[model samples]
Target: MPRPASDKRERLTEAAITLARAHGLEATTLAAIATEAGVAQGSVYYYFKTKADVAQAVADGVAESLASARSTLGPEPTDALVGFLGAYVDDAAAICAHGSLLATASAGTGSDRAHREAIDWLAERFGDLGFAAEAARARAVHLLAGIEGGAALAHALNDLSPLEREATHLGRWVANASA
Candidate 1:
């Protein structure tokens, strides 16, 4: 029996993200991604038309997690924001490490805007916690910058402590902003 299309697409995007992170986007090729994904080279085109398209899917995957995180939070906005903070902190290594590659490709449809879309999603959630619209957006951007900055540093130094600390601080900041 044939595997599901969604599963194949998911695998391809994930492979792309992982490869992009490890090898750098410029070094990661469609052929390489197909090999990494364990799909035939031609099969890759069935799901994604270009590397940017696959990159965009990767972004959407990240954003989907944010949406899922938001849904899991209870009715209280402040607590939810804190939950998001913790989640981000936990995922800091991945996010920070992939920061450069992902950001550089922020031009495609779907997942290309995933990073900004994720931020926007978080900002909206922040608003739910009683912050003014602008303030909520500012807080979201602030958290993003700090976490990604830490990620970038961690990526450079081969360490995760910076990302962890930034994630923690941002969580606190989000809590305080909501209070």
Candidate 2:
């Protein structure tokens, strides 16, 4: 039987993400990614020129996921920010592993610009919520770091309390900080 086209590329990207998450970016190899995706190693090359390309795609996917989550936020900007923070805080475990992969890969691949682009999107959204531009940018960076740290703590301690607790504080901070 013949196979479809897009599935291979999608699978390779997904496999790259999963491998990079389970194993650090340095350890995730093209062969490993291909094995994880259940495809020939050569096929990954057909879609992505290098492992870094896959990493970039993973980073892009993470950013897209955050934006997609934010799309469900209500009309109010403050509410939207709160919802965005909550989305991460509430799912810290998964978010941690997933975000770590993107973070690790972004650094390894020198895709800092891509990471910054995502952060910029976030800052712009906050700016729309009435925060001063610089303040919005700073706050966005702070929240992203905070949530990632919160997620790491949640994972290391095998406890969700820190994340759940941080979510409330984050929501309040965004509200007050923007005001």
Candidate 3:
């Protein structure tokens, strides 16, 4: 029996994510994705017109996961901000570690709705810490940049120390800003 459309698409997306993380997006070809998903190569085109479509789907999934994780943050605003940074860094590091293609492609482009929403969410949290609205927004962008940069650096160097150091630095900055 043939699988449902959703199931096939889901399988493709999962394969993309797994392969992208393991080998980076540039190395994750459509044929590989299809093979990994146990589908014919042409089926990949049936579900997604291009590899970039698959990448966007992966980005959407990651964004949703990140948002869900952020929703569970503790009540304190600074703590919440710090938690957000940790979540982003961890996710990005994992997703981008092989060659950092996923990170460079998805998070690097600040045009996505999920990225915008994350900025707004962080800005709101910063505002709750008594920062001016504009300042809060700016700080939110800064924090996101830090997370992306740190993750990319860590992945490129194939070391966790950069991620760790970035977390510590960002955490301290958040604390001081809140103080």
**Whose lDDT is greatest here?**
3
lDDT of 2 by residue, 1-179 (tens): 88765688777777877776666667888898889999988887888887678778777766666667767877777777788778876666567675566667677576665457657866877888777989889888887777667776776687877777777888788778634
Better of 1 and 3 by TM-score: 3
Cα RMSD of all models vs. native, in order, equals 3.2, 3.2, 3.3
Candidate 1: regions farther than 4 A off: 1-6, 107-112
Model 2 Cα displacement at 7 (Å)? 2.9
lDDT of 3 by residue, 89-135 (tens): 56654633522544544753432756677889999999999999999
Error of 1 at 65 (Å): 3.8
lDDT (Cα, 0-100) at 171 in candidate 1: 75
Q: Write the candidate numbers in order of decreasing lDDT.
A: 3, 2, 1
Q: For each candidate, what is the lDDT? A: 0.73, 0.74, 0.76
What is the TM-score of candidate 1?
0.78
Number of colliding residue pairs in each model: 3, 0, 0
How far out, in Å, is residue 35 in model 3? 2.2
Mark the regions of model 3 whose C-alpha exceeds 4 Å error after superposition. 1-5, 88-111
